[model samples]
Target: MSSANLDPLSRNLLIGVLALAGTLASFAATTAPIQAAQRGAYEVTLPRTLDASGRGIVSGTMWCSEGARCAAPANGERAVSLCGEVASQFGEVSRFAGPQGELGSDDLARCNAAVVRR
Candidate 1:
């Protein structure tokens, strides 16, 4: 129903409720994006495409798809450590970039060392 048909008291109440809802919606909108911005992301380029088997993914936080691409939420971890996990799951990382920036050559070497010896 339209607010114009309401009694004055009910109209004011409805306006107050809508204003409060708008305030809450705006507050929620601000905070959610801020939290997401604070949590940086990780992207990886693998040396090869992961097999279509379940082994392709690293963890719940990391998602692998579309051939050699993988991504995860950085979640305050170092590039080196996160890269190691990705390398361990999939294989050597062709490129690893995260909140702390891309892994250096030495770091990449160390990260790849965690690869399973299979």
Candidate 2:
């Protein structure tokens, strides 16, 4: 029932399992950000810098500067999907480059659709 009631071998085995689990958890925690830092790999460039007030957008991408550039870590989302996210946050995306390559004219057109026309 309690630790005091457990034999030495059993207790050692339990400790080993717990330690292993902790190590695994720690490993996952550290590896996630690294993986996130190197995924989807899409960069979105807008027509102009963000308004003087907005310096960056972090909600949808890894880092988006006010200078009309955004890089999305996008996890496993399709390039098209990430382009939409960047466009929605930073305005129409003029270019989107991902793992395979840059989006084609048609795909770029679709990616810009997320931008609200003012």
Candidate 3:
């Protein structure tokens, strides 16, 4: 039978099936991991400053990494979160303004020194 002879519901079902198939094909094509291997590194830096309430302000850059996913926070801030394998090795580093009651130089050093395998 010709498509024009098909009922509205049947036509709609066919269209939906075709659209679904097209979407699945496109997704499969783009989702395959590229054979090319990407490698890189990053550097993070923060300013040594204190706020009125004694919270540390930090700013830094990340390079090599795919994105700016590993940089410190900006001014008027107290702390920032670090993560990934690097963070695990280096203990999460969060710079706070003022005197950290329990967190001191030793803690900072340990955290900053953490290294993670790629």
Candidate 4:
């Protein structure tokens, strides 16, 4: 009835089960943050009459223009994606308005600020 009385094979099997459970727990802990990071937050500035919820009816497709600076590894792409996700949730589709030519530091600052606000 105890580990001392169990056969060698039974003891090994119990150890293996315990090891597997520990491995699974550690794996979940490490991947939680990565999954959350991938789903970046986007703060959209809707008209004063509208909110993230589809309360105020905007009767047209939403437009989003990504600047050239967004292609960099910074918060550009993620913010745009977040905007798309939120827009879709509120029953409005989004289309990119081509590249933003001649982006400056102010552009990146505004983009990064939106993400932080989300």
The 0-to-1 C-alpha lDDT of every candidate, in the order given, reads 0.77, 0.75, 0.39, 0.43
The top-ranked prediction according to TM-score is 1
Q: Point out the worst 10-residue segment of candidate 4 by lDDT.
A: 65-74
TM-scores, one per candidate = 0.72, 0.59, 0.29, 0.37
Q: Report the Cα lDDT for residue 73, model 4.
A: 16
Candidate 2 shows a clash count of 0
Quick one: RMSD of model 2? Answer: 4.2
Model 2 lDDT per residue over 24-116, tens place = 999999998888666646677888987754444445445646467766555566778777767776788788898678999899888888886
Q: Is candidate 1 or candidate 4 better by TM-score?
A: 1
Alpha-carbon lDDT of model 4: 0.43
Off by over 4 Å in 2: 1-7, 52-63, 81-85, 113-118
- After superposition, candidate 3 runs with Cα above 4 Å error: 34-118
81-101 per-residue lDDT for model 4 (tens digits) = 444444443323222222333
Cα RMSD, each candidate: 3.4, 4.2, 14.1, 11.4
Runs with alpha carbons beyond 4 Å of true place in candidate 1: 1-14, 53-60, 116-118
Q: Against the true structure, whose lDDT is highest?
A: 1
